[model samples]
Target: METTSPHYRHTKIIATLGPATQTRERLTALTLAGVDLFRLNMAHGSVQWVAEIVALIREISAEVEREVAVMIDVKGPEIRTGDLPEPVVLTPGDQIHLFTTNATAPAPTDVLSVSVNYPDLPSDVAVGSTILVDSGLMRLKVLNKDATSVRCQVMTAGTLGSRRHINLPGVEVNLPSLTEKDEADLIAGIDAGIDFVALSFVRKADDIFALRKFLDDRGSPARIIAKIEEQSGVRNMDEIIRAADAIMVARGDLGIEIDYHCLPLVQTQLVQACQDQGKPVIIATHLLESMIQSPIPTRAEISDVSNAVREQADAVMLSGETTTGAYPLESVEVLKNIIQSIEPSVSSDLNSRIKLIEPKEKMLRSTARLAQDLGDSGIVVFTRSGFLAYVLGALRPRGVPIFAFTDNESIFRQLLLPWGVEPFLIDFSADPEETIQDAFERLKEKGWCVPGSWLVVITNALANDKVIDTTQIRQVE
Candidate 1:
């Protein structure tokens, strides 16, 4: 398989592997089509199946003489109602009573008995609070609250099935972010040498730290990615961004939390913030929604993908389009086309738009600019959360490519979408000097640089530390 493409030089595409495209041949075709990384959604399949796919991807990459990253997406905390006999449809203005007590529907009413795992569900919910089911397929407004049940009125009419997802906005649905299932999956991913682990529904920085500590305790350190979907995530955005290895703009659940009309603004703000902080941002969900069935994409979908590329998103992803869609191969091809077509139009003058601060910020930007001005072969950024790398990329410094070396595997894989950023995963080291030397030698071995060539290394002096204390411009020898 030929992995090189003129159009893919600046941007990377991530294709998900699922039941629709799990064959070795299909995977090979996707790789040939210029997929820089493969996302293994652990939320959908068994561990054995995912392990097979990961092995196949690595085998194919080795055979093709190309490097491809694999990212494992963990199933985060998700709340849902238990089984229903059939799809239940509700109409606007209909009174739907959601109860903890057993009840059946019949009397000109849309009341349904919903099973909630949380014992204090009724107490946590307040009147007038919104309840979104199955990503807003059905909407319910709280009418009255009690100790065990909450009466509600249907706000939207739609069919809902068994185990349909439930979303409570502005209400703290107390649940562990990482479930036992996710912990098992994380262990499997780490054992498989997976490049990334994406944490879903992250609400605070503590969640990230806790996961990191867990990995550390297990002696398996995978990069932790915080998927921003809830209003709490957006409110704690700055701290969350600072804590995780990378950030994912998960628009599906986000739409359920905030108004759909506000998604575009949220997307832009999140992307800009990630860039400003130098952390890789992934624009996920419904990038090619129409392509799930059609062989090609709608004009709006094309524009959406183009906008992500123009925004300099590290990578653009297709969830169902490449996983369980009818046109998996066609979806990958169409995404490749859109990415290739829109990449050249990306402005290389993004550095001027970056807002520079003082002390560390000024020093980091100065080093990045110097590298670009001196025509250094590449700029090496050692980041825990990928913030430094994103900042350098946002600067849009020309001539010098940005190589992000991190211990976090999720950050390594999530970086596949950013313009000019090549993420590499390495063993966590305690010495910055050894880390810098290793990076320089690795780049030289890859012919990315030569002896006597200029290279800029920017990293926090302390290993596993967030504070940036050093920036060095060195002549490779």
Candidate 2:
């Protein structure tokens, strides 16, 4: 197949690298199969293995003469049960006691015993809150709560082994999103020059800012991806979206947090929000669940992928399918074919389905539309807030390259997957005109525009610092 096959256009594929597809040969095959990015899940493998795979991916990208982004996923603070003798199966209506202490034997009477690391977990959880174990494989309801323990009735019983994750829905478990292990992994990823670092379980914008600072301190400038898994993250989605480079709809844990039936709606809302902001959003997890073992995807799975494409997600990720699948190559091919089949059906109109409340008051939108109308060779947005770039992105002008110049390196690096948006970090200009001139000169130097090409510049006007107020169309001379 041709390397620049239409099958891969406009759709970014993130394949998880694992024992099955860790070799140089398999990595090369995946890249040729249209994998645009490689995911090194730090939760599963050692730092040495991850480092080896990262090196292999770079080698493959060099051989192909294409830039393939590498993402290192940090395993955030996950609360889990202690060691169990074997898989413990519970039937419906079974009573279970989760305690803080590590007790080897089963509970004295009607209670099944399990241990939690946090001693005050029971006090933190209130009655009526749901306890999800093993990534929502089992569900329990808190019937009573005390200072150190909570009594729960099993809602959905399943076999669970040692270290299965525990989630308390609607209850904030006081824990840091980035654990000690994650901090070490982040350093390793930065040292390896990973393109993106996915921060798992991001609850607020502060989490993103902290991670960005961490990267700066390490002198490893990588794009920070905020994984939206909790309800808090979703509620504060706009702030988080503004703070990070991109957002990932981590559906696995998200499904555990919200009703499964509500997932589709949540996914749609998140995609639209990201689109409106001009931020790239990824629909992740279970896109091709059956492909782990089988060569083909289920009809429902195909439809799911098609729906995500239709929703205009910049990327769709496969976790286990590419990581530990029996048919990793076939899975990639199937994903490629599905995206190719769906691309033509995707709407190209920038504002076709956009529902902008108070559209007249949105100066960024006005500037973006004016930029599109000016018929410039390219559009340049000078923004410290990243709002202007996102506004221009929402316009979706055909064939016009959008360059985002910002002093914030994090904002610039995050624009990697957004359609037509190129992020560059420039020294902050003293004035707006200077900023525009500097942008123009930089474009010329980079060969994005010639001396005679028209370029549109958008930025904040004096009247409203909160909104974009200036749209200047100038021909470079």
The prediction achieving the highest lDDT against the true structure is: 2
Query: For residues 414-443, what per-residue lDDT tens digits would candidate 2 score against the true structure?
Result: 554565466677897668778778877877
Clashes of each: 12, 0
lDDT of 1 by residue, 139-165 (tens): 888898666667788898887678878
Query: Residue 353: error of model 1 in Å?
Result: 7.1
Model 2 lDDT-worst window of ten: 1-10
Candidate 1 weakest ten by summed lDDT: 1-10
Candidate 2: stretches off by over 4 Å:
1-8, 102-110, 351-394, 397-416, 420-477
Per-prediction TM-score to the true structure, in the order listed: 0.80, 0.78
Residue ranges of candidate 1 with Cα displaced over 4 Å: 1-8, 100-111, 350-391, 398-400, 403-418, 423-477
